[model samples]
Target chain A: MPQKNTLIYSNWWKYAGAALVLYSLIGGLLFVNPNNLLFLDETVRNLNYHVPMWFAMISLLCISVANSIMYLKTFNPKFDIIASKSAEVAVFFGIMGLATGSFWAKFSWGTWWTTDYKLNGAAIGELIYFAYLILRNSVEEQNKKARLSAVYSIFAFPLFIVFIIVLPKLASNSMHPGSGDTVGFNKYPLNNNLRMTFYPAILGWIAISWWITTLLIRIENLKSIENTDEN
Target chain B: MLLGLVSHNMFAQTTENPFYSNGKIYVVVAVISIIFTGIIIFLIRIDRKLKKTEKEINKKNQHKD
Candidate 1:
């Protein structure tokens, strides 16, 4: 278990996160967009809810990969548990990003799914992580599973970055903003008014996600501790 | 026919659907609701697991006593 003094065990950040999210929820809807977005209309407010999911996913997965590296160096089962739990939360956020993105696309792009580079790239990236989970389940030995999945995660992170972040930028005709010829939403659609909520929304979402990850980590730690006691 | 009604609802983006009305403010409400619901469900699952863990701990303590 993380010591009581440790930041993860601290309760302040969770409350702060909840407060910021509440502020964003009210501010996101109440704040008027200074610019009229073509094809987005009122759905422009989805920026506060949808965009944050990807940010939180990337942050959590980065933590997961970092823990995997730590596991490799120290051979600590704790690090392996943290890495897997982080990946689990990251995958959940990724799915939420996809679902919300699909809904947003249906309104703006006139389709639920699209052939856009970013869309396809995100889908493929999600599948790779799903495969990682399946690979872990396939191995029975604890140490071997940890070692193998740690190595896999080390490799998977780079591939995930390439698919979800890099390839889209390289694709010339990609419809996603910030990829290809299109500028990000920050360039035109997001005015100072929207930024007020957008930045906090991202921070709040990341904090909330980390809160959940820590809870899962504590649960896993408790389970292991109990098993050790039994034996 | 029911098929025609379903197709019209899907293809026509019917305003009769409550979410499409009132300048579509309800869409924002729907998005917010979905996010909140997802978070609550996650917390509920965690709560159940924690409860089970607590019960096990209590049983172990009783056995020790």
Candidate 2:
């Protein structure tokens, strides 16, 4: 068995995550929306759910890349396990974000998907991480796989940033907020009630992602132990 | 004074949405709540399965020892 001190997990944040998300769910639906917004209507409530998924995705990807860097520096398999699991959770959130955004757009923009820069950027960013998963699977040796993927993650993360953040701003016809003529959340501005719920929703999602990743890492550790025993 | 301010504000803002007034918004809320509940339950199930697997592995290790 591994040392007890080595395996540090906290239950407090897990409960907090669940509670915050519950609060957000209740507050997000019932809270008073600011009156008279063009196109968005009642669907502006999606901001509490959809926007936060992207925030959680970005946060997870940052953790993934940070772990990748740590793996390179320390050559620890544990860090690589975490890095890979974080990316997996990030991809899960990215897909959720895309689905939610597409649903929102269908109502607001009158289409499921757009040819806009932000949409394409988000698609490409998701594709890059998907390709990272494929790269991991293709490698035969574990150490070589970890090393190569860590390098790829470190390099690709900046390009991913450019796709989602930088490119949208540069493009003229982008429909997402803070780009072109589009008014963002700032222009409409979340009321005090919405802000209270929204911030907690982001925290809740990040905590949930962390919980899932830790569970995955623990499973992998158990599998490794089983493999070593068989050998 | 606070009661006067509250009454004044209530009269001042006459925002109208048919869905909210008719209680249809609660339907939407119910649907969202169900979806969120389902996802959380699924996560909890997965966590339980992992815990079971860990326990089985620990048992096997103890048997080997």
Off by over 4 Å in 1: A1-5, A189-192, B1-65
- TM-score of candidate 1 versus the correct structure, residues matched by position: 0.80
Q: Scored by CA lDDT, what does every candidate get? A: 0.81, 0.81
Q: What is the TM-score of chain B alone in each candidate?
A: 0.62, 0.68
Pairs in steric clash, model 2: none
Query: Once superposed on the true structure, which residue ranges of model 2 sit more than 4 Å away at CA?
Result: A3-8, A189-193, B1-15, B55-65
In terms of lDDT, model 2 sits at 0.81
Candidates in order, TM-scores: namely: 0.80, 0.86
Query: Which one wins on TM-score?
Result: 2
How would you encode candidate 1's per-residue C-alpha lDDT over B1-65 as one tens digit per residue? 95564445433333443334355664775687578767856765775677577568757756876
> Residues A103-126, candidate 2, lDDT per residue (tens digit)?
888888899999988888999999
Candidate 1 lDDT by residue in tens digits, A152-181: 999999999999989999988877888877
